[model samples]
Target: MGDDSIGGRLSEFIGNLGGFLRKFIFSVLSVGPIPNHIAFILDGNRRYAKKHNLKEGDGHRAGFVALLSMLKYCYELGVKYVTIYAFSIDNFNRRPDEVQYIMGLMHEKIEGMLKEESFVRSYGVRVHFLGDLKLLHQSVRIAAEKAMRVTANNTKFVLLICVAYTSTNETVHSVHQCFKEKRRPMDKFQEEEQQQQQQGLIKLVDLERNMYMALAPDPDILVRTSGETRLSNFLLWQTAFCYLYSPAKLWPEISLWNLVWSVLNFQRAYPYLLKTKMKRY
Candidate 1:
């Protein structure tokens, strides 16, 4: 056989072996309770770029590749919902060039996913752009809307991308929307306001229903890369009962083992989480 043919066969063999191993590992993990929803904070992209002496944009590109791998792993593990902190409202405070680069990158990626052979189609994933999408760049916002519309019928899994987002902003926006929806006759509004006090008559359900994150349930496991302990205004309200896992690795350095270990730790704490949730209800 030619040398090129031999090398190709060897590479294929290794790929198949890796696939088998992953499936075996996941089958064992299935014995424990798997998280229904997993959320991620895409941290350390800029740091990774600095550490590697690469352009800031290149680091984000690497982070995008890492994101694809994590998505594949999450889906293979039967996680129905995956949410990513793709871009935060706070991020716009960065250098103007950096913000523009990131937005362009987002536009590119969203367009890529709309292709027939893209990851979303392969996995039957529904795409949701959560939180203040109006804050996105016009081109990026249009791309996001198109992706959501294109994938609206997919039923097997979901991907929630938080761009131009902050939990505080989401909460405030939800409150405003709730008030708009609950608007009544002036006299009725006054009567309700007086009965409910200065806070108004808005119930928790009303706020929750208006929330941008209401498309999916609260995340069961929230993994923030780069050892960051803070939510950074990402999902303050939704994460109240969520398990938080911070890996020391940067976003681009996240690996299969990081995901596996997070799942293992969550499995260990499943009973406590369930019990706590039950009591709260």
Candidate 2:
């Protein structure tokens, strides 16, 4: 046989072996309670780029690959909802060139998601772009809207990408919406009752329903890469009961082992987390 044929066979065998191993691992994890929703804070892309002596955009490209791998692992493990803090409002303060580059990258990725054979299609994921999408470039905004429209029928999984978003902004926007919605010419008695309940007027449910993240339940596990402990204004309102796992690896350095370790930690804390969640509700 030719050497090329032999090498191709060997590669295929290794790929099959890896797939088997992953399935076995996932089955074992299924014995424990699987998280219904998980969120990610994708940090350290620039740092990863600098560390690896790559060009400025290369780190982000690498991070994107890591994101895909992590998503695959999460879906295969039966995680139905996955949210990612893709871009924060604060990120716009960076160098103008850098901001434009990131926006372009986002636009590219969004277009990729619309492809028939893309990850969203394979996983039956309905894509949601949360936050102030108006702040996005016109083309990117249109693409994002199209993606949501196309994926509207998908029911198996959900992917929420938060771009131009901050928890404080979400809160303020929700509050404003609540008031605007509540002030629509109520009856005299209703207005009087609302005034009386001014101290407790904006109920939690009202605010929650208005928030951009209302479509998905609160995340059960929030994994922030690069050992960062702070929420950095991301999901501050939603993560009140979420379990956080921060690995030392940078975003691009994230691997299957990191995901597995995070899942193991989550399983260990599942009981306490459940109890805490129950008490809060």
Candidate 3:
């Protein structure tokens, strides 16, 4: 055989072997304890762009590609819920043009969800926009609604995109909703009469029920890209027992190995996390 042909065959064989090995390891790791939900703080996109001297939104575009790939990995590992902080309420403070670019990107992505991408259909992933809908642009709001409507029947997996979201705002909104929903057994008059009574006190369940992403459980693991360790107003109420992982890489720079490391960290704390959950219940 010619050396060129021989080299081609060998390279192809190696690639196939590598894919098999990755899947095998992922399977083994998932056998013991898999995270039911994982939250991602896709940070440092702008920093990455500046570091590479790329255009304004190029880093975010690259980050979106990384997100799509990670979604596949999460699906393979049987993660039921995946949440990403796509855009924070604070992000609007940037320059008007920059904010407009981000909103346009979000609108495009939400429109893509309505088309039911192959991965979405394959995994039965239900798309959820977790934020104040009224705060979004009218066009984006319509697109988000359509995406949710298109994926409402899916039960296997859930993909939550937090746009225009803030933890403090979520908490305040939940408090308002608690009264609107009448979560407590006591009536308004009774609650007023005995404000100090346990019946009038807000319970954990009441607050949780009113949160934007109340349908899914709190994230078992929260992966934040970049060197920062703070929550940055992401899932504040749901992070009490979450295994927070901050890799020293930008959002677009994160890879499957980063996810594996995050999973390994979660595995290390599995016993304690499980005990905590049991106690809460």
Candidate 4:
């Protein structure tokens, strides 16, 4: 055989060997117990779009695609619950045109999920919209409701999408509901309420039952893409003990490898968490 032919064959063999090694590593990484619930703060959509010189809607579209891919990976890793921060209450403060465009994209994404061949159906993923629905546009709210209704019966996985959600607002809303349901007048019960408060009986959990995502398990791991370190008002009550993973990649650029790396990091740090558990109040 010619030297060129032999070299070409060797190159092909090396490429195949590398591919096999990568798959083997991923499969091994998938072993052992996975986080039962994983939450993602999907940030940097607009920044990604601007960096790529794409339109406002295009960034969100890319983000949706990324989310769909991530969901499949989560299921493969045996994660039963996934929550994503899709939209924030503070987002409504953006330019009116941008807000309208984002709402339209949200509708499109929900409609896409409703199609029979979509990932939500194939994976038996149940959708829940966790947010203050009243603040959203009527059309977007309806689309969210329809998506949740369609996926209500599925049990394979729980997908929580936070739209127009603010942790502070959710907490305040819960407090308001608690007060509205109080049987005694404020003046008459003021002393008792203060006593209960001192005893920690009137704390956030007393009102948490009324907040969105109340039924879902708190996230074991909270990941924020695009190198953002802050939680940005996501799941304030739910993420009380979550292990946070902030990767440098943008939302649209996140992949299974990134997730695996996060998992490995979590595993390494878990012993410290275990040691600290006794001290956690």
Residues 1-281 of candidate 3 have per-residue lDDT tens digits of: 99999999999999889779779979889767889999999998999999999997998898988999899889888899999999889988999999889889988877765554567776788999988778888899898988888899999889998988999989999999887765547666877876656645667888888899797988999999897899999899899888999999999999989989999989999999889978977
Task: Find the 10 residues in a row with the least total lDDT in model 2.
Answer: 193-202
lDDT of each: 0.93, 0.91, 0.88, 0.84
**Model 1 stretches astray by more than 4 angstroms:** 184-200
Q: For candidate 2, lDDT tens digit of each residue in 107-157?
A: 999999988889998889999999999999898899999999999999988
> For each candidate, how many residue pairs have backbone atoms clashing (under 3 Å)?
0, 0, 0, 0
Instruction: Judge candidate 4 at residue 221 and give its lDDT.
Output: 86
**Tens digit of lDDT per residue, candidate 4, span 50-93?**
98999867888898889888887788777899999988999999
RMSD (CA, Å), each prediction: 2.8, 2.1, 3.9, 6.3
The CA lDDT at 137 in model 2 is 86
Worst 10 residues of 4 by lDDT: 197-206
Rank the models by TM-score, top first: 2, 1, 3, 4
Model 3: what TM-score? 0.87
Which pairs clash (backbone N, Cα, C closer than 3 Å) in model 3? none
Q: List the residue pairs that clash in candidate 1.
A: none
Q: Model 3 segments beyond 4 Å from truth?
A: 1-18, 183-201
Of the candidates numbered 2 and 3, which has the greater TM-score value?
2
As a whole number from 0 to 100, the lDDT of residue 263 in candidate 4 is 77
